[model samples]
Target chain A: MLLASLQDVTFGYGDVPCLEKANIEVHSGELIAVTGPNGASKSTLLKLAMQLLHPWEGKVTLSPTNTAGNKLVVAYVPQQIAAFNSGFPSQVTEFVRSGLHTQSSNWLRRLTPQAKQAADEAMQSMGVWELRNRRIGELSGGQKQRICIARALAMSPDLFILDEPTTGMDKESRKSFYTLMREQIDRHGKTVLIVTHNLSEMNDMLDRMITLERREEGGWKCCTTTLCSGHFAPAESLH
Target chain B: MLHYDFMQRAFCAGGIIALIASALGVYLLLRRQALMADMLSHVSLAGVAAGAYLRINPSITGFIVAIIGAIAVEYVRKAYKTYSELSVAIIMVGGLSVSIILMTMNKTINKSFSSYLFGSVVAVNQLELTMMLAAALIGALFFFLLRKPLYIISFDEESARTSGIPVQWISVGFSIITGMIVAAAMPIVGVLLVSSLIILPAALSVRIAPSFTSAILVSMGIGLTGTFTGLTASYELSTPPGGTIAFILLLFLVSGLCVRKIILLASKSTSKKMRPEIAVKESRISKNGLSSNLQKIRQR
Candidate 1:
């Protein structure tokens, strides 16, 4: 299923159009990576696809339902989100549990037994269970990153939109994270659209890759993108 | 103090505003709009000045104007998303300037302006008390019913949107609630010290509380304590109630910070002494490659 798409899109922060005439599509159950040089508006492209940003021209579509005819659940982890509110007064357990809030049908905002189970499972999976009682502000950078992903994991959404989710993680943690993401796709069939810089590390795991590049056009910097079949192509070949 | 009917009204008004304002402060502080209370109070002052000039009740006009100011700020905040505080500053200047001009137009208005500026215990009339009670009741219901979505949106509006939340509407509703509480609180704390009632307790609680819910509770506790004690002190020493309340809250904030710092330092030292090996291992983990190595081992 087509989860989300941006076609013939033109967007920019100011008067000059930086990302112009860009096209990208996200399919259900596929892990897609969006890579680009700095200032290429890669994050903008993701935002456009997610309908978080309206395009100056053309169309953006996000399917309202999943394959099973249920309301689509989406979890987004924006770039530098851990650093965004580092001083947010919350414990690790409490923060992770919040991801389940949308899933609750009642208006009471009470924690159900199922939500508790899901939260604990997500924390344990992300290795943040040991630090569940610790305040979120007190955690290390990588630890903070893990808990954030864990929070998203607890949501168990149909679509995951992540931007630089591994910024503070080490190589081993990154590797484990990839393995975990693979399990999420292969076992549970969740669609993920991620913006990443580590093309070499993520190349093998991606089903498709979208690359954004900028070229000078008529005295203005304009962006274009290339979509490639990921599993068969090497990361170096794209460059 | 309770012997007087006015004193009873004053305590009731103070307690109600303290709870709602402090609660609203947590959301405002987290959203990086702490100066909003100060800005709205100033804007409400302009409304008061206009009310007196027009031969209307200043409190009613002030309440309407504060809500309008809040909506205006919300729109302006969107225009300057990267520098949201600029909106507050811009609105504050407009509010203060208008109020000053209006106050100058009516020379006799200065007699009542001091009470609005500095606050008086007797300012909490039956009408003001009723307004405060209504605001508090509405504020409490709003907070309770929308707590979950508010938490998510407070963390990150963009992400909250993707999670299927109506971020825009909730944000506007939150602003309206803030305006109502700020306007209601003006009678008790006045324009100058109103924000102290909102910001100080939340400022301290956000630092010291272990979790978000606790932060709200702790702030309310601090606000109630400060309000009651300040009122008592004002009656005893013949001090202005608003200044006395603000001063007490300020003192609480200062002492809270000091106590928190000392406790953190003490805990660190004692932990190091109690578990030397664990401390050494932690340092080594920092020096070496990944803390995930320890995490990995712990996972096993």
Candidate 2:
């Protein structure tokens, strides 16, 4: 089923057009990688899919099959965790536990038992349960990334979007990240859209790869490895 | 210090302002908008002057003006989007300009400010005390209800919005309440020193606190303690209460930084001590195993 779709989408900041007439589709339980050169609007497309931005001229739809009543739960991690730095002053557990506020209806927010359990379980899954009380600023790059991923897992999201999550991680950390990605897909059945420059290292956990190309005049062109075999010989070489 | 009713009222007013400033200050400091209090307080100065000129209660006028300034800040911030501090700077400049004009128009406004200007704890009358009490109670309620949202926003705005938290409304609400609290605190800490009350305690808290909740609690304690200590010290030394409070708060911040540095150094020393001990223990164990292997070879 279609998890999200964007049709004839064109968007820009004032006069500089970034995306034009872009059509994209995401299916349930699929891990899709979005790759592009700088200014190719890969992040822009994900934002539009997440409804963080509206296309200047087209329609964006999410959870088209499952929108009977409840809004789909989405967990979106931006490229940079700007507030996170050494001496930022917060514990890993508190930061992870904040994800449970999404399920809260009360103005006075507290984590319910189930939400707490979910957060703990997520932390355990990410192998950061032992570091729960540690300050976020003291964590390593890989550990911090897991903490953020654990935060998303605690949300029990139907759709997950991450932008350049592997930018600072090493080879071992990237491998562990892929393992976590497989778990998210095979176990939890989430539809994921990842913006990455590490596509060459993204060995086979992906369901699809979408490439965005910046055009000569303005806007961008969207292409998939499968549909345009000529552009990428053997399709796998696109990675 | 406790011999007079005015001293008692000063303590009470000081305690309230300390608590309110501690709570609001932590969030502002975390957001890197500590200047919000400073800017709003400056804007409130014009109101204070206008009130004296017109023979109205200055704190009341201050409250109204600061609230308006906060709203203006929110609007200007939204319009600028990229440079939010620019909005605050503009408002601050405009406020000081208004203050200069008001002061020039009515020289008696300086006398009006004397009661709260240098924080004349001796001058806190029944009306000002009641006003401070009411503002403290209301600010407490607002903080309690908005605590989670505020935490979420401060931690990360993008994640907060994605989580369906009303970041915009919570931010605006928080800013307004902060302005109100600064105005209410004027009589205790004075207009010039209000930002110190808001930022100093929180700075001290974050330096040593292990967690977010503890940071807030520690800040409140530091604030109240610093304020009361300064009040008592002022009475004893015949000094200006506001300047004394500010100096005490500075002392607290300095001590906090020193403590954190000492702890860090101490931990590093202990870990250095443990590393060589671990290495020796491992070497001894390996030597024992080697001797056992040699004994086995001899038996063979």
Candidate 3:
């Protein structure tokens, strides 16, 4: 259901454009992984897709409505979010429950029973329920990452954009995390565009992979591939 | 103190600013904009100087200029995303420089400006009290209605934006609110010491509170206590309200931090005596700022 697409996008931090003429598309119910080497601007692609970053010269479009014809709900987990703001004074439950703030109909009203259940189920699935009462600052890196993912999970968004969501998790935890994402896509019909370096771990779960490669002329471009057979195509050609 | 009309106004003004500004401090501190209140106050001073020179109402001009400064800072902060503090410094320099030049040109206000500089809380008139009340009401409503989104943005703005919160509008609104509070608070603590009311309470509260909501409550509690105590001490000692209030808040911060350290140390020693292995692991987690492994060990 063409959830989001960035076509011929050009963006950069400084004078020189780092990502030029990059393109990618996300459809509803598809689990996609965006992978590239260090400095390949993988996160930039996701940011562009989410409208967090404006493209210097290209069209970046997100569906205003989901397949259900309601406002499209998106949840993004930026890289190293927990580590960057480690000293933030919030209980794990409080932090996770805040994800449902956007879903609540009234700003001042209490969380509905369903919303509260979603928050609890998210924490339980992520294995952070026991640490619900603990301060977020007190958690380890892996624990922090899990709770952050749990926060996004609680949102029950139509689209999930995650950047390196499994940075510090153990092998078993990472596998379970992938399984949960797969369930979100298959059972709930959610769309996911994840930025990851652990391509091998998520390869099986992902329907497609987008790799950012540096051009000889000095900017980056997106190369899309179907995960199972590795059938490659230029990002612009895919759509 | 309560018998005198001016004293009554001063206490009322001080109490209101303490509550609103302290809650604001929690958000500002969490957003890493601790210096924003200080910068806005300095910028508002430039407006005061200009108003005196032009024979306009200084408080009105100062309030307008503070709001302008906040909006300017928000725009500049966006440009210097990686160096957000640099935007604060740039605006501060511009503000202070203008103020000094304006003050030099307006000698008639030199003697009278001490009230605005060092803060003559006892001199708070009806107009200033009304302005403080208005700002406090607006601030209280802003914090209460937007508490949920504000929490998410404070933790991670990018994520909050993707989650459908209007991050830019909220960010600018937050700045405007900050400016209004800073300007309104000027009469009580003056420009120089206004930030102490906004930053000090939250600084201590963030350290000790268990959750985000508790942190705000704790900050307000400290601010109210500090302001009341400072006002009493200043009245009794015949000292400057601005300096006295700032000093009291600083004392609260230092004492709060000291008590927290003492408790942590006591816990460490007791844990070491009872479970040496767990104590060592706890220290390791504290040292490195990671605790998942410890949680795993506890679960096992």
Candidate 4:
């Protein structure tokens, strides 16, 4: 089943268009990697899919079952880890537990043994279990990224959207992250849509690649390539 | 001493302000916008000065004008998201400028500026206490009802929006609550130090607590303790109560830092001792495994 669909979407800030006429479809249990240059609106596409930004032109729809009839159950890991001030002094466990913000009226009252177990499972999956008691400010870049991913996973979301997940990681850490993602997708069948500018690093792990190109005619063209083809041709070229 | 009505009123007013400030402080610290509270406090000074000039009730006028200033800050922030610090700087300057203008106007009108600047705890009547209590309760209710969305948005706005949390409303609601708390705290802590009552305790708590709930609890304890100490010290020393409270809060913050450092040092030494033991155990396990393998080979 199609988990998310963006039909002829146009998005921008004020008058300047960041993305135009872009369309994409995501299926369950699929791993789609969105890659483009820095200003190519790859992140914008993920934001649109996550419903963080409204499409200026077309409709972006999610399957009702996943959204629980309200919106998609999306778990997003943002690109800029620095967006959070490190000096804020939140514990890793507390930060990860914020994933359950929607599960109860008061977050303090709803932290039962079951919820803790789920958080522990998420931390264990991300290899950050030992760091749960540590402050978030004390963590290294790779560790912080993993903790964020664990936080997103603790939501038990139907779709995980990550923007530049491997931006600041070392080679080994990036490989380990891809291994973890593979385990999540293959064993647990969680759908994922990741936006990254580093195409070469994620080439092997991606099930499909989607590219957003700014056209001379004042819009964006989205082209998708299956893993078997090993190349992303232009949508117009394919037509 | 127990028969003194003013003392009872002072305690009541101080308690209410402490509650509101500490609760609001939690969100301010979490959102990393603690400085905004300070700016709001300064802005409320102008409100108090305006009230004095007009011979009106300073608390009511302070509350109204502070809310308007807070909303203005939010609008400016929204308009300049790319340069958020610029928005804050503008608000700070605007608030300071208005305060100076109002204070000058009050001087021309022969109104005393010291009462608004330093506050008069002896002047906190029954009506003012009632107002403070009402504001505190309302602020508490607003926080409790919107805690979930507030938490999500505080941690990560993009993630919160994607998860279907109303990021915009949460941000606006938090700003409004901050304004209300600033207004409520002004009469007790005064415009100069009111924001400290709404920021320092929470910051100190965040440094040590494991969770947001614990942080808030710790903040409330610190706030109440500081408020009582500050009031008593001010009464004894014949100084401004707000300055005393700010000083006490600063001392608590310093102690928190020292305690945190000591804990870090202790944990580092303990980990150092355990590291060699872990390495030795791993080597011994490897040696035993090799010997057992050799014995099995001989038996085969």
Instruction: Give the winner by DockQ.
Output: 3
Q: Candidate 2: which pairs clash?
A: none
> All models: lDDT?
0.88, 0.81, 0.90, 0.77
Q: Candidate 4 at residue B56, lDDT?
A: 86
Docking class of 1: medium
**In model 4, which residue pairs have backbone atoms overlapping below 3 Å?**
none
Q: Write the per-residue lDDT of candidate 2 for residues B1-300, one digit (tens) a residue.
A: 587988888888899889988988989988878899989988988888878778888778888899899889989987777788999999999988987788888886666666655667667888778877887888889888777777777877766777677788888888788888888888777778889999999998887888888889999999999999998899999999989999999999998899889999999999999999999999999999999999999999
Better of 1 and 4 by lDDT: 1
> Mind giving the per-residue lDDT tens digits that candidate 3 earns over B106-215?
88788878887778888988888888899999999999989999999999999988888888888999999999999999988888899999999999999999999999
**Candidate 2 ranges beyond 4 A from true positions:** A1-3, A54-56, A61-68, A82-85, A104-110, A217-239, B114-116, B274-300
| Model 1, TM vs. native | 0.93
Point out the worst 10-residue segment of candidate 1 chain B by lDDT: B285-294
- Residue A42 displacement (Å), model 3: 0.8
Checking candidate 3 for backbone clashes, the offending pairs are A140-B291
- Lowest lDDT sum, 10 consecutive residues, model 2 chain B, at B109-118
* lDDT (tens digit, per residue) of candidate 3 on A1-239: 89999888888887778888777778898888887778888888888898999988999999999999999999999998999988999999999999999644646789889889999999999999999999988999999999999999999999999999999999999999998999998899998888887766764577888877767664455555454444223444333
lDDT of 1 by residue, A164-232 (tens): 899899998888887788789999999988888877786568888887765545433343344556452
DockQ for each of the predicted structures, in order? 0.61, 0.48, 0.74, 0.40
Q: lDDT tens digits, residues A63-137, model 4?
A: 756524444577889886634556545778888888877644435476889888988999998888999988877
Q: Residue B19 error for model 2, in Å? A: 0.9
> What's the TM-score, to 2 decimals, of chain B in model 3?
0.91
Task: Flag the better candidate by DockQ, 2 or 3.
Answer: 3
Which 10 consecutive positions of candidate 3 chain B have the poorest summed lDDT?
B287-296
